[model samples]
Each structure stands twice: as structure tokens, then as C-alpha cells.
Target: MSLRTKFMLALLFTGLAAVAMVGGLAYAGMTKKVDSLRRERAAEHFHASVTAYLAQYGSWEANRGKQGFDAFMRSRGPLAGDRPPPPDDERRPPPPGAGRPEPRGEPPYHFILADQEYRVLLGAGVYKHGELLPEAARKNAQAVEVNGRVVAYVSPEGVITPSRQELQYLAAMRDALWFGVAGAAVLALVLGVLLSRGLGRTLGHLTGAVRAMHGGSLLQRVPVESKDEVAELAAAFNAMSEKLARTHEELNASHQTILTQAEQMRELSVRDALTKLHNRRHFDEQACTLFSHAVRHKRPLSMVIGDIDFFKKINDQFSHATGDAVLRQVGEILRSHMRLSDLVARYGGEEFVIAFPETELPQAAALCDKLRAMIEAFPWHQVHPELKVTMSMGVYADLAAGTAEAMLQKADALLYRAKETGRNRVCFAA
Candidate 1:
């Protein structure tokens, strides 16, 4: 099932298939060759028998009188009626011109007399007597001549023929084929099993390593015991796994860095440059969320909008550096008095905004009054020793407010009114 096992099985099967195919073809070819050789030998034997029989017949026909030819022809069996008699028979002292006695009913002898040229002469066989030869016997038959006369004859019984030799060779080939196939099959099976076992063991180790990797054990590796390809594959796999683990760690670190940078960017976008407090942009975004929560959860929310009194006069009298220090001090004081849940932002130059969740307008106004009194009492000249600062504060509370914008507008209106009435005072939105 594992890669190594699969590979081994693939190789085993491929070898088996190739061997089987080639072995089968070899067996077939060998069978054909052996059969051909056997057929050739059988043909030789048949030709030898036929030749020997013809020589004896020819000698007897030439030397013996008509009696010998008659006896030989009779012993050999029938022939066609058109065959001429032997020369010895032809020279017989027959009644002058008695016209060769009506040849005995289709003479027992069948001979084909040769022409003066002594080439192949007429021939006959049992076939002419209406006796059909077997395929093997027919193939064994050959034309011969007796005393320069042609004859057709077949080998005696038990003589080898092409078909018989072919059958014998085929039988031997079948036996050999079965033996080779069985031996190959056994060998293949044994090799396949042994290879499968080795492969299975290797794959088992790889599988275990993979499972460990899945379980967060990145250091796990497959065991390698050889210098084969599987070992190389294991090494490569381990390298890849290590690389992936390192890459994953790097990606995680990068993700954390991005998150940190994003948080820092958010802070930078919303903080006042001099005061280091939430600027107007942050106030707008947070105020909307706070307002929604107050409306949905029925929680009181309050806002305090304040402006530094005579801030431009202070900057003009001293310097921008002094003005900046004053703003920084005010931001510090505000932050010190606020709880973690409260938000304080520098709304604009010399203006600050404060938000309180679950605080009523009266509580927010009282806190602003406290902040005003503290600023008035504190010695700003300790650091500058020459500057004095005051702020006008306005407070508003959520009453299921028309909108966050409307609430901020109301608070801003109060802040302006406080500044108009006096430079340092706290006002509340009715």
C-alpha cells in the first residue's frame, strides 16, 4: 500500500510478466524447431525406405525372367492397368504377334515404364486401386523406378513419417514447457514474497514516520538501512519534511510580525503627535462602537470635550516648545485620572475628548470639574516656572442618543459655551 511496497510489487510483476511472455515464446519456437527437425528426419527415413525398395524391384525386374517380375509385382501389390511390362516379360516367346494376351485383369503389378531418356515414367499406387492412403502414409510415398520403369511406393509399417515425428517432438516440447513454466512460477512467487516482505518493512517505517509527522513530531524520520533507492527516497523525504517544518515556523513568525506591525500602525494613525493620546480619528471610530454598545446594552456612556483656555496666547507669550510641554502635561494628567475603560483623545490643537462607558452626564461633569481644579492647583512653572494653563470642559451623556455625532455636537457646543463664559470652567449639556 505504501510507496515502497507498491514500487516493489510493480517491479516483481513486471519481471514476472516479461519472463512468462519470453518463456512462452521461446517454448513455442523451440517446439517448432524440434518438430521441423523431427519431420526432416522422418522424411529422410521414408525416402530411404522407398529408394531401397525401388532398387531391389528394379534389379529383380532386369535380371529375372518374366516370372521374377511377375512375382515381385504381385508381392508388391496392385498397379494401374496402363503400366507396361518389364523388358524381360516383353521378350517372352509369345505366339508370333498374338497381341500381348489380354493383360490379366488389371495386372497385379503396377509399373510405369520410362521413356528412352530414362526420366520419370508412369506410376501408380494403392490410390489407383481405390485405397486412400492415410495423411502420414501419403506424405511418405515417393516415385521410384524399377528397371528404368517408374513406380509409386510407400514405406513399410512403423516407418517414421513427418506427422509422427512432429507428434513426438510436440509431446517432448509440452513436457519441457510445463517444467520450465512451473519452475519459473515457483521462483517468481518466492522472489515476489521475499521482495514484498522487505518492501513492506521499509514502507511500515515510512508510514510510522508520516503518522508521527501528522501528530506534530516534525523530527521523525524513516529508518534507512541500505544504499538502495528506497533509502535515498527516505532521505529525501526527511529533508522535505524538515524544510516544511522550518517553512511553517518562518511563516508563523512572519504572521506574528505582521500582526504586531498592524497594531503599531493603528496606534500611530490615531495618536496625537505632541500629547501621544488618541487623536480625533481614533475618537470617531471608537465613539461609534461605544455608542452602539450603550444603545444595545442599555449602558450609560458619557463624553467630555475640553479646550485649553488662552492656549494661543500662552504659545505666543512663551514659545511652541512651552505650548507642547503644556499639552503633554495635560494629556498625562487626563490619563492618570481615567480608568482603563475610559478613552481620552486629542480632538485637535488645544482640544481633548474623553469617553466614559457606564458613566452619567453628572458623574462625567464632576470628573471634569476635578480635572479643572487639579490643573489650576498644579504648578505648571515647576518645569517651565513661567507658564500657567487652564481648560474649559463640557460633558454629555447617552440618553439613547439620537446619534454619536449628535452627542459629540452637543458636548462641543457646551465646551464652546464654557470657554465663552470664562477661560477655565466646566459645563454640562442639558
Candidate 2:
């Protein structure tokens, strides 16, 4: 069952048990009181009957009445003929002066009578003739002495047993008590069911919100209806969820920013600062990878190493700033003239290198001569009209040159030879 139903059942049962216990206790107390009253009335009737019987009759008649009393006792019938027995010693025949035996069986009326010494004389029902009476019956029973004999007596005022009317009344009361308990229990059940349903609905809303959050929707919230504790709990939970959603968004933004910065840093690390080209470090790495590929594929590879002729003299005549400008201009020219597949880099101050994949030694030399002629024909004197610059180029082609460094050294040697012969010219290795 749902939580609401279970809670209602528990509350209803508790109310029912409580009402039943209270009704049972009340009924028991009332029944005891009524039974006590009935016993008291019976005692009073017994004492009165005995007293009246002794007062009207002489000794002989009284003796005769005793026989009647005995016969009544022996009859063992209903209340009509019931009587108390004579004393054990007095069970014998009466003395000569005693009167006729008492009428047989119990008298039509109830009475009690005691003699001078408080010994029983005559009695019926709950009281003995001469016995000391209980406190309940003493007030109503009359005290007397007949012929020097003391007696206490009472007459029956009403029936001393529980009447049919009283029984019916008690039975009705018991039924009413049960009915009241049942009615109260049903009312409690209804109230409990309503309360529990409200509580369960509140909990269900909270549960649905939690499930939505788990499914990646952090914006869900529980509904609040009352100003009770459940409403307060829902408010707190909504606040916490809002905080978590905001924190998640911030973390994601931060992570994306970090990733973008890392990419920029990687690009900066591989690029030359002045020339805006791959630096010597990056070129060396590429050259090694390319050389391995060329060896594996058995493809021709060629390289060019070039240097500005009399570069130190130009720097001394002008200034380092002009020398740097010259190098930057030359880097731009080389980049523009080179094919897309070729790699170019500033090797050092006034020195540069280029890689040409799938090119023979003759083709590499021709390309180097074209680049030399292009650099020599450029109008350098326009910016510094008194200055002139020239470059010497060397070409090398061989995959089995042992290493990229070895191939570059060979190219460098050829470039030194070209400078020795004349600046602004290309030279090829034997």
C-alpha cells in the first residue's frame, strides 16, 4: 500500500483500541456498582421479614412456624417457598410449651428478626433471624426486644435482585458505548486518511524533482502548498539544486577557456618570433620525419642552404636594425617563392634552409639559381640607397647522407664554395 494508506490505518486502529478500552472500563465499574446495590437491598429485606414473624406469634406458634420454615427449606423450590434452616441444636422436637410449627416453606414476604442475645429467631432471604447484620442493612432494619429478647428487623421494600429493567438498561448502555467507539474510530480514520494523503503527495513531488535532476535537468523543483516542515524542506532543496547547476556551468566554461589557451600556447612554441615562419627547432623535427619517409618510400629529396654574403660588413656599415630588416625581407621573399610542399626556416643570423621533396639534384640547383637571381634583382637601394646585399646558395640531394645534419653540412660546404667564387650565385656538390 501507499504510505498514506498505511499511516491512516495505523491511526485508525489506535483510536479504535483507545475507545474500546475506555468503554470496557466504564461498563465494568458501573456493573460493579449496580451489583453492590442489589446485594444491599437483599440483606435489608431478609432482616425485616424475620422481625415481623417473631413479634406477632406466641412461643407455641413460633415453634410451629419453625416446622413450617423447615418444610419450606426442604422444598428446594423457587423464591416463593425459600427459607433459612433452624440451628443445628434446635433441629430437634419443640419443648411442651412451644406453639404449632411455622407455616411450611418461605413466607410470601421477606423479613429478619434477632432475639435478646442477638441470636437468630426468624429470618428469610439474605438475612438470618438473630445474626448481627452487615453495615449496609443495619440502618433500615429495626432494633427491638420481644419478651426480654432483643431483635433487629426489616421488611422487604422492593425486589432485592437485579430487575429485568436494569438488565435491559445496562445492555443498551453497552451497545451505545460500542457504537460510540465505532463512530469515533471511523471519524479518526477519515481524518488520518486526509492527512496522510497530503503528506504522501508532498513526498511524491520531491521524488519526481530528484529523478528529473538525475536525468540532467537541474532546474526542476518540488511544489510547496503548506507552511509546514515539508514545505521548508522543499525550499531548501531547491536552493541547493540551483547552486549546483550554477557551479556546473561555471566549471564547464572554465574548462573550455583552458583548452583554448593551451592550443594557442602550442602554436606559439613552434613559430619563429621575427620571421613568422617555422623556427630551426620545428624545421629540424620536420626534416627528421620527412627523411624517414623518404628512405621508406625510396623517393628523391633535395635541400638548399643559403647565407647572406658580407653580412657582418653590412651590419657594421649601417646598424643592427637595418640588418634585421634585411633578414626579415629576405625571409618574406623566400616564403613567397617556395612551393607549398617545401619547408623554409631561419637557420641562424643571416642564414636560411629549405627542403624540397621529390626533387633531383639538378632541379634543386636550378631552383636555387632562380631564387639567387630574384634576390639580386630586388631594389634594396630604395630603402637604404647606399647599401647592397647578395646571397650565396648551395643544393644537395641524397637520402643516404646518413642524417639530416650530414646532408645540411654538405649543402653548407657547397654554399661556402659559392661565396668564395662570387656572391649572388648557386653552387652544387660533386
Per-residue lDDT tens digits for candidate 2, residues 219-320, read 767777788998899888889889888988898899999989998787688777787677889889998877887888988888789999888988999888
**lDDT of candidates 1 onward, in order:** 0.71, 0.74
TM-score of each: 0.69, 0.54
Top candidate, metric lDDT: 2
- Runs of candidate 1 with Cα error greater than 4 angstroms are 1-141, 153-176, 201-220, 398-401
Give the 10-residue window scoring lowest on summed lDDT in candidate 1. 108-117
Q: Positional deviation of 353 in candidate 1, in angstroms?
A: 0.9
Each prediction's number of clashing residue pairs: 2, 32
Evaluated with TM-score, which candidate comes out highest?
Answer: 1
